[model samples]
Target: MNTESLLRDLREELDDGGLRGSFLVRDLHTGQEIGLDADLEFPSASLVKVPLAAATLERIRRGELDGATQLEVEPGRVTTAGPAGLARFRHPARVAIDDLLYLSVAVSDGTAADALFELTPPAEVTRMLREWGIDGVSVRHATAELADTPAERFEPGEVHLAHALAIRAGTAGRGHPVSQLDVSRASAGSARAYVALLEALWRPSEVDAEVAARTRDLMAHNLLRQRLTPDFGSDATKWSSKTGTLLNLRHEVGVAEHADGQVFAVAALTESRVPAAIQPEAEILMARVARTMRDHLRSR
Candidate 1:
């Protein structure tokens, strides 16, 4: 694959659409790679949950955390949006830690993520990744604190659309016209950094093998596959990944293993100039770009 030429083409295409993004694709087994703005940092949205879950599972493996521990539902922990699990709870309830982990990653449940974050703070997760040699990745806060703006914060009483709109209105500190914070202060990582982490998850050397496998298992069940799944061609392509979404940013990073055992780690992180919270075109562009990259790598 002519990675250099491909990236140049991608840059021009994205620029034509007023979209800016970062990409890093590496053949895990061969180590051949390609990237575009791969070193630039972007918000880690729900993608941060991957490492958060990984760190939590590692602690459980080391006996620092007990998966069987039960946690009580508090008012602040319930997120305004997301799937069943913590967000759907109507009353005070106790949930097992293992279930919380599943909800956090599998379903991108914000409430469940906050619960895990309480057990494994962002700093600990960041340190764990760095220790494993995954550099340029920084997890600074829980999903709850990533908002950096009052309107963007998960207020249990507030409507989800309003919360999202506030973020789109740029109520926070500094950002492009679309959102207050296009990038997250809570968690930030470059595409290359995420590719490194995905490589470790695919073939564990620095991290615990069992824990890494468990993390990959959880990510493989990721409910949000609309972004990059279509490009992988068929169900035969195994994509174990994590996705991140904010007001204007959309990202997915994971390893795609073909039927022949060929493996590639792909990170597609993008920011749209459109101000609307819902931009279906951005999502489509992501899938198209990923498909183009995947085909380039596979044909090689």
Candidate 2:
């Protein structure tokens, strides 16, 4: 039941499942933790939604934005990647703030994230992190810069040149590898910052009440299918979360607050050899940790 034994068991489970790198799990209330390759930074997919959502709402609290404000998805704004919510619409989307937040959290909509990213550029997102008193975070590449991704990284300005370099140097504005991802629009984040965001949310003193509430509402609406939710874990525990995958990455992060107030915030992520269609295997590995942690807490 201790962290060392718990970590040893998790490593075995992930290895048996053929997972890559590490996953992180924490005891939010007690400050205890179990990590298998947790600190190793890997690309955070939709997991970035929590921060982006908090940043947008933080702006609203500052009067920099009106909560019900709207943005028109001009031809240039509409994109085919990410979640297909409005894209499923018959015409270009002129989504309101509510709808954008809904689609972003509910479905991990790439387009929705781009919309928010458009309103709050990555550099500005970093600013929000500092203002909120969160640390170990940096976001410099605007989601819109995705447009400059070279058709190939070998050729500068390809799809992900900006992002690729950023990830390598552990900083944003560096560059992203394009050619591989340039074909389609994409974005990235880190696990450490993601949890910091949730920690901030769980204890909203870091930001205004209105901002925390709105962001929580947005996340609440966006429910991800995970091992603990109705969709994946066979009704084990209800989870309001974001699920993400691409190439080799599989991830999910959210607050799992039980009826008893034994809330646990988990960020389970990994790079994997599994194909995109079956990436949930990595999540399943993380879920094993979640189930165990939940058991330990219940025993208390």
Candidate 3:
């Protein structure tokens, strides 16, 4: 099928699935690309961790911060919303900066991310990205702020109401009643911007090679693999990625390196109109759509 027809079909499919997203896939070698609303911005939930990791490593490389330094982290000191890492610890633990990077990026640990944020504030992370010549991704707040949404107020059985509110409360300008969902108020990025980040990591340019390599390694070790990993990962391919999620938003950005030396950077940032969470079908649809784009680019 031609590009126009394929994009039209993909748009229809996403609408049918009650999803609206910004997706981009770019061939690293040739700079060729394809997308659906790639420039549309979405509140970047945990996705900010990637930049956090990069900035932290950059500081380490510059001898400003030592990765071997250990910090005392108290249990439940940060947000308890996360399902993994230091968020679940029952007691205070002293974790090294390097291990904290692993927990923050690879495990999507909100507490660990906030811990890192303490060392390098959100504004500092944004400054670091600017210094690296990365744009379109804005880091405005820490991970702890992400846990304070309406989703947390609702009873477990009625959490869908929060999702419903998330779906219905957005303005055409992308403002939201919930600060965490508002692009202006929350950390946000476009698919193209994230794909650019992936490109920088996969093919270092403005970002230092060592920092990018370490960031890429953290993504490769990511434990949250149920989203796009199934489609992009295989024996013949290596998929390195980071996932971000909030009330109704789900996103994943990664690089797929084929054994044949072809590398494609993909970013899928999506918001669901569906009220219910835990939509495995939505996750599957996202992966399929992104993989289809990758396959298309590969063919050309």
Candidate 4:
């Protein structure tokens, strides 16, 4: 396919919308990355689940957490509206660690993430990331990275578990104070680093193989829609991803596998004053960029 033409087309579409933000797309195979204000960070929203999932598995690897650890569903912890809406467990159903992580990522389950955090929490996860060379993660909630972590003073040892679980619980339109600005303060992402994180999660040569594989496995089962690969191509185009949207932000960062060992890392973050009910416009913006990146990979 002619990728350049598609890129031009997508760029024009983005321009027409006048949305505010950055984007980044890279061909993992050829190592070519395209960026446009791609460093701007929006709320990770649910998108932060990707990294938090990695943190959970990494904890399991260290034996600090048994993915099989069970947790109970508690009131005030599980929102009445999100993935944890059914709430009526009085016995404290001890959910397994892996299951909790899966629920948190795949379904963006709030109670599930809360259960996991109660086990190992966010401050600890931030510590692990520091050892892993990850910087600029706002030290917000333990569940994800986007809305909570203030970019300027990321801490490896603060209680971020509650913050982590909130976004996953399906709370929409909430914004943190640090999230009011770009450059880490406003909890946003540039297309470049966002895609970089996905590479670290899916492609082993790019990140720890065990962590990447485990993370990919989690995403495959936690899809909210039949978009991307299935929407654009086929098994010839397999995508492992997690998306985030809240208030004025909409983002999706993931890995897509194409024919002939071709892989691509894409991050699409957009912002608007409209609410989540109007998120489709944001989706259209991201889809244009993602499709262009996929096409770009095939051209290689």
TM-scores of the models, in the given order?
Answer: 0.86, 0.76, 0.98, 0.75
Could you give candidate 3's per-residue lDDT for residues 153-236 as a string of tens digits? 877888899999999999999999899998999999999999988888889588999999999999999999999999999999
Give the number of colliding residue pairs in candidate 1. 0
lDDT of the candidates, in the order given: 0.77, 0.60, 0.93, 0.59
Model 4: residues with Cα > 4 Å off, grouped in runs: 1-12, 75-92, 142-188, 205-207, 226-233
Runs in model 3 lying further than 4 Å from the true structure: 77-82
Model 2 misses residue 48 by how many Å? 1.9
RMSD of 3: 1.2
Candidates in descending lDDT order: 3, 1, 2, 4
- Give per-residue CA lDDT, model 1, range 89-124, as digits (tens): 677778889888898898887778988888887888
For residues 1-300, write the lDDT of model 4, one tens digit per residue. Answer: 355566566667776764555667787767787666676656566665666778778777778777766666564332222233213233456566777778778877655665666665666755655666665444346433332333213343432433333223332343444334233343344566677677666555434678878889887765665434334446577777776655445666677777767777777777653323344555666676667665655565
| Best-performing candidate as measured by lDDT | 3
Measured by TM-score, how close is model 4 to the native structure? 0.75
Q: What range of 10 consecutive residues in model 3 has the weakest lDDT sum?
A: 74-83
Regions more than 4 Å wrong, model 1: 75-84, 146-184
Better of 1 and 2 by lDDT: 1
Clashes of 2: 25
